[model samples]
Target chain A: MAYWLQQILNALQLSSIYALIALGYTMVYGIINLINFAHGDVFMVGSFCCFMAAAFLGLSFLPALLLSMIGSAFLGVAIERLAYKPLRQAPRVSAIITALGVGIFIENFTLSLAPYPKVIPPLLKNITWALGGVTFSSLQLIIILLSIGLMFFLDYIVYRTPVGMAMRAISWDKTYVPLMGVPVDFIISITFALGAGLAGAAGTMYGLAYPVIDPYMGIMVGWKAFIAAVVGGIGNIRGAVIGSFILGTVEIMVVAFFPSTYRDFVAFTLLLLLIIIRPYGILGKPRTQKV
Target chain B: MNMHRDILLEVRDLQVSYGHIKAVKGVSFTVRRGEIVTLIGANGAGKSSILKAISGLIPYTGHILFNNQDLQKIPAHKIVDLGISQVPEGRGIFGNLTVQENLRLAAWQRGDKQEIATDYDRVYTTFPQLKERCHQLGETLSGGEQQMLAVGRALMSRAKLVLLDEPSMGLSPLLVREIFKVIAEINLNGATILLVEQNANMALRLASRAYVLETGSVIMSGGGKLLSDPRVRAAYLGA
Candidate 1:
């Protein structure tokens, strides 16, 4: 029973991280209609940024986290301006290819800087609480709380703010939004920045929980989070969170009960089945074009 | 009024093509201040193409001058900042955003938040349905309400000129009448309007001057009353 409780706790921690990163993918896709393939590498960069700030600059954990978020946001804005903006008028396939190329570039760049995985020094690794025979670390608590907080903040910004409205408008019809005097590019850039910032925070928390960092770390986790986004219904924040938890719990439970090697296949099979059943995912509404 | 003498928008020999097919060819017209200038045409008559070109959505070869400034050199967003707002065809409101958010996004380029707030109140007063569904997502609004939100959004920009593309499309007959009434009211309140419509009768009724387009070219041009002439009635109005 304790082992089962531990697995649940682990699943929750993993889900929180996936939920945070998946929000970025979902939000960007919602607004721009482009799957930011490089989003995963942004997570990798965020972890590395945190590593550099903490290990090299000798900054505290909090400051390092902030620095990582800022650095990732800057990178997000630059990537959007340099790589994605030019492809705005191009076909969707071209943009998708460009996103893949960007992902490769970021991964290669990080590998050149730090070729091998490094263990993140354990600062908050000590167990902070025990509930129902399950131990919870401070890192786990922080990850869950921060993820929830960021998700709520993002929901507020997207639903309650003017910029959020512009983002939604552009998502529906790009040409009309700009004619209303809203600078569409600026709003799009800001959306990229916000999504990247959330991913960075997720990265920081992920490093703290697992205490491992590598250039390729973002690929697998990024793909899983993206899967979570699709599972929950891409472009819906609530869906992303719900999807993350479902994916995380399912993966953990499968690993516990079945062969660990089958986990990846199971997760992907679920994604494929869900897509076939409902292409819009769980939370996405079907959009009908006017004649 | 006499303010129609002040030309606000001038398009000279504008040509737009989609690869091998030309959508708008050598179309030219002028919209005067405080007058409703209507462009009437069939589905393939290039009325929308002209509006798209004027707003810089589609690349075109032509001279579009607003207040004597060349519009061809500027981007679409800058065109909005230059005080021209378009309520696109099918009432292109952001389906996921609320009525208030839709209005707020329209005034994004403006810095006076206070005045923008006042404008919000003004829009709500003009479209009470929008006020009642202020918190509801745009997609949930009825077709007529969406059209009102689209116009309300354009008004929030505080534009000197408003371009309406098929505002009465996909609406009930009663709703169509209400939309036309709002368009005239908006024009009377000191905003130049360029209305594009397939409904020649309604367009002519609301506009001071009218242009008839056919297959990417202007077929006729005259006072709005002339659109009801025997020849025009037979050709376009199906008399």
Candidate 2:
């Protein structure tokens, strides 16, 4: 019972990070229908930014996290405007290729700056609590609570606010939205900024937990988050969060029961099975093809 | 001179193209204040393209003046701020949004909260059925309800000129009559209208002055009397 509770806690921690990154994927895909393959690299950049702000600039934990988020938001907007905006009218395949190319560029650009993986100096007081044979760390508590708060904030923005209404409206019929007096381009940029900012926050938390940062770290985490988004329903925000938790639980349980080597194999198999059964993912509704 | 001042919209030698296929070739026309002006034509006659260009949906060369302001200089979203709203082809309502949500979104550029609230009430008053289904998703609404929502959304913008494209398409005859009645009533309430329609009989009946487009050019322009022209009757009115 204790071991199961421990695994559940680990699953929640991992799922929070995945949920944050998955939101970036889902929001971009919802509006423009592009997968935004470069998103994982943006997460990596956020980690690196947080590391630098904390270690080199002598900033505290909260300030460094904010800086990382701001930096990532800028990078996200820049990537969209420079790489994706011009291809807005181009074929879908072209945009996909461009997103891949941008991802590669970001990965390499960060590598050139820091050739080796850097360890983040611990900023938070390392305090572990033991209660009835179950261990809890402050880092774990902070990450889970912060992630839940962010998700709720995002839900409020997407469902309750006017800008959120405009975003949802654009995803439905982009061409007609402008005629209703919405600045569609500006709204798209804002979406990217919001997604990247969340990814940045996740990066800071991930760095604090693991304490190691590298240029390519975002790649694997990014892909898993993408899977979560797809499983949840690529465009549904609530679905992304639910999918991430499911993925995290599966991964944690697989590692706990079997050889750690088989973890990815079992997780990917589950994703494939889900896809075969429900191609549009759990919460996704099939869309009619428009002429 | 009095007539010239009354011209609310004037298009001069406007042209639009898509990959070397000139969709609208030097089409010129005028919409006067307090009149329902229409551009009538068959399929592939560039009627929709003209409306799109006027609303800045597509790139075009030549001059379009709306309320004496050059439309060529304005972007599509800003065109709505200038009080020109287009219903667009096929009643472009957001399927995922609710009726009330759709109406509120159309007023995105307006700042007068009181006026906007009144407009919402006015839309519900004009189409009481819309009020009944205010919370229902747009796609679930029937064809006639969708058309009404589209027009009702246009009205929410508080536009001086509303551009409607094929408002009668896919609707039953009874519903079409109902929509036309609302259109005429909208005109009576002091909004100038520019209607684009393939249904010439209905288009001519609703419009005070009309322009006939053929092969991307305005082939003829006149008052409602054009409905009597044998060529128009035979070509458009099904002689």
Candidate 2, DockQ score (0 to 1): 0.78
Residues B161-184 of candidate 1: C-alpha lDDT, one tens digit per residue: 999999989889899999899889
Chain B alone, candidate 1, TM-score of 0.96
TM-score of each: 0.93, 0.97
Candidate 2 - CAPRI tier? medium
Error of 2 at A7 (Å): 1.4
lDDT of 1 by residue, A44-140 (tens): 8888888888777878778888998999999999999999999998999999999999999999988887888977665453667887788888877
How far out, in Å, is residue A42 in model 1? 1.2
lDDT of each candidate versus the true structure:
0.87, 0.92
TM-score of chain A of 1: 0.95
Q: How accurate locally is residue B40 in candidate 2, as Cα lDDT from 0 to 100?
A: 93
| Candidate 1 CAPRI-style tier | medium
